[model samples]
Target: MRIIRAAKVLTGRQGEVIVDGEVLVDGSEIVSVGPRGSAGEAAEVVELPGHTVLPGLVDAHVHLGFDAKVDPVTRRSPESERHLLLRMAENARKLVSAGVTTARDLGARGFLDLALRDAIEEGLAVGPHIVAATRPITLTGGHCWYMGGEADDERAIRRVARENLRAGADCLKVMASGGMMTPGAAPSWVAQYTTEQLRAVVEEAEVRGKGVAAHAHAHAAIRSAVEAGVTTIEHCTFFTPSGHRFDAELADVVATSGTYVCPTVHGVMWRAREVYGPEMLDDWLRGIASMREAGLRLIAGTDSGFGAAGVDNPTDGFVASLEVFAQAGYGNAEIIELATVLAADACGVGEVTGTLAAGKWADLIAVAGDPLERLADLRNLALVLVSGRSVTQAGVDTVTASVG
Candidate 1:
């Protein structure tokens, strides 16, 4: 048995906080959590004075295969599968070291992410628990077509979905609209697939007990994805050719349907302002705020890959997203939930890993200060525990240690 004592603990559910908290772990699961001394005596006890402990963070949207570089698609194609696998393993370590215990990889080529997932599960590698999509279903010549998931018709879509399931995909990602990264593809605001086509993909995934994540940015695409009943809407920008547009009716439908939305917000404000101008950035922020006001369930996602500006690291990008929400007037508690409990729920793993509750996986992190007071304190992570195994100590990767 192991007991981790901290000055404060954020339960990551219902905004609960425990002072002088202690969490007891037996094997890979949490035995109990409460004030200090609640666990009585343990075989091993680690004290973290002047620190706050909370559930390990989850990044709901990521592409493990893309190496976060300018033009990552082209850079990724030539690499051999073996090379790509090795690179992904390194990326996984980076994520776990930064206090990200769970991650949902929305897209990857050649099913490489699944191999990494299995490796981590089998203890062959030290990394975050990965929920991989395998290969994203895209349209003919649509965004990310080079990954070889292009499907134009219903039959093709169903076939691809089945193939992914056979390949052990945890979820299905369908590109409902074009993307900024793909040249000559449809505009971000243009729908790549019809509503019926998207529905087919969603139906197939749901029938097989898998969730579907739709890559939607345009207003029309967002509406179609909502109508298709996708589990989560990725990049729900509600964008238009003219500028940012928020469709209230569609947003209401999404809220009513209990669909989670990942806005994919991870960029510096000043840099964005330089490109889109201050007025456009303000409108974008207002749109996000309006969605929250309309009862939309928003989760944090960095779209961390391809060396994007603010998404250099999974944990760092997520923290930056929380800061963005904070700047947009979201309270610290609410902002933290977006990356912790809310993100885990969005990725379909809430019961197993989101909170510091009994019977849950002991996946949590300890930081130097209270995150509620300053969200940036999360960057000062002291230790990371995944599945009750210590993966990092004092901001560095260390050999996994058994508590008992």
Candidate 2:
């Protein structure tokens, strides 16, 4: 048994915060959480007098196979499967060290993400609890087609979904529209799959007790995905032929449909400003604000590994997404919820993790200062614990046994 004493603790539920908080852990599960003195003496006690403790973060979208280089596809083409697995293990360690105790990997090649997830669960590697999608289903010559999950018609879509489930995929990821990565593919504003085809995929996944995540960028595709009853929507950018557009009616429908949205906001502000310009960036921010106003459930996710260098680093891209949410007018509590409890719920792990609650996994992080006062304090992580084991301390990584 261990007791973690901190100055403050955010439970990540109902906006609860305990002063001079103490969390009790028995093995990998949390036993209790309350005031410091409430927890009796234990075999081990870790105290932080000036730090705030919170649940470990959950990133709703990520790509473990991506290397975050200039040309990730070309960089990965020549590597053997063994080398690719090695890189993925390294990336997963980086994510865990950065306080991301749980992450949903939306895309990967050759079902490597599944192998990595199992390896971590089997205590062979240290990493976040991964909800892996295996390979994203797409159309012929569509976005991310090189990963080899291409299905055009309803029958093919059902077949692919079944195959992924048989291979032990945690969920299904379907590309409803084109993407920015593949050259000569359909534009982001165009839909790649019909509504019936998408429904087939969703129904098939649901029957197998698996959720479906849809990658949609266009307004039409977003509506189709919402109507198809996908578990979540990724990168709901609402792109048009000219640029980005926001449809309030559609947004209202999405909000009412109980669908979660992952904007996949990256922390690289300078690069975004350079590419989209100030006015355009402001427009994007406004769109996010509008989503919030429409009562849409937004979660924090960095499309890490697609192109932003250093995104896979422990403290860079993930924190940047929170910072972006703050700059867009989210309160400290709301932003924290998006990363912790909300993110976990979106990824379908709410009961197991995401909060400093009894019977849940003792996955949490302690920061030097109060994040409510300044969001940047999150970057000053003092210690990261996943499944009651300390994997990082004061921004440095430490090797620990993998706890499934």
Candidate 3:
């Protein structure tokens, strides 16, 4: 048993902050969390007098296979599978060091994300708990066609979905619309799949007890995905032929259906000011604010591998994504919830992790200052505990012990 004592503890529950709190851990599960000195005897106690402890962050959307470079796609045309796996392992570790204890790999090639996930679980590699969507479903020669998942019709979509699920995919990912990464493919405003096709994928995953994540950018694609009942919508940008637009009726429908939206609001979004003018960037921010007004369930997802500024070191980008929510008029506590509890819920891991509660995995982090006041404090990670093991720590001993 061990006690992680901190000056403050944000249990990842909105508005629940315990001052002078202690979290008791027995093996990989949290035993209790309460005011300081309430947690009883333990084999060892790690104390942080000026720190704030919170649940480890969850990045709901990421692409572990793509190297976060200027052109992550074109450069990877000739790499072997072995080399890609090695690179993915390194990226996973980078995510861990940035305090992401749980991350969902939204897309990958050759089911390599599954292989990397299994390797991490077996202790052969170091990384956070991974929820992988192996080989995203796409239209023939559509976006991300190089990843080998391309289907022209519903039957082919079901076949590809079955293949990924059989290979131990935690969820299904469908490219409902085109995206920016692929060149000469359908543009972002183009809807690639029909409502019936997306519904087919959703129904297939539902029978298997898994949810489908739809990569929808076009307004039509977003509406179809909502009507088809996808678990989450990635990059829910209402793209048009000329520029972006926000449809309130569609937003209300999405909000009513209880579909979570991962806006992928990271540092790279600011680059829109250079390409599309400052007014467009301002409109983008306004759209995010409107989603909140419409009661849309928004979760934090950095889309880290897709040219996030400082993607190599993702801590800044992760926090910057949250900062965008702040710009959208969210409070610090609410933004924190988006990255922790809310993110975990959207990814279907709420029961096992997310909050710092008893019977949950002890996935938490301690920072030098209070993130509640200064969100940037998250970058100053003093210790990170993933399932009760100290993966990385500063100013603390190499804590190791057996259950007693």
Order of models, best TM-score first:
2, 3, 1
User: What lDDT score belongs to each candidate, Candidate 1 first?
Assistant: 0.84, 0.85, 0.86
Residue 161 alpha-carbon offset, candidate 1, angstroms: 0.5
TM-score on alpha carbons, each prediction = 0.93, 0.94, 0.94
> Across residues 1-404, which tens digit of lDDT does each residue of candidate 3 receive?
99999999999978999999999999889999999989988999999999999999999998887766656766645689998897788778778877889998999998999999998877677678999998899987899988888998999999999999999999999999998778878998999999999999999899988888999989999999999999999989888886669999999999999999998887555664666567767877888899999999999988877674323424226776787788889889999999999999988889998899999999999999999999889988898888887776431122111101
What's the lDDT for candidate 2? 0.85
Candidate achieving higher lDDT, 1 or 2: 2
Instruction: Please list all clashing residue pairs in model 2, or write none if there are none.
Output: none
* Model 3 residue pairs with clashes: none
Clashes of each: 4, 0, 0
Which portions of model 1 show Cα errors greater than 4 Å? 74-77, 274-276, 307-316, 393-404
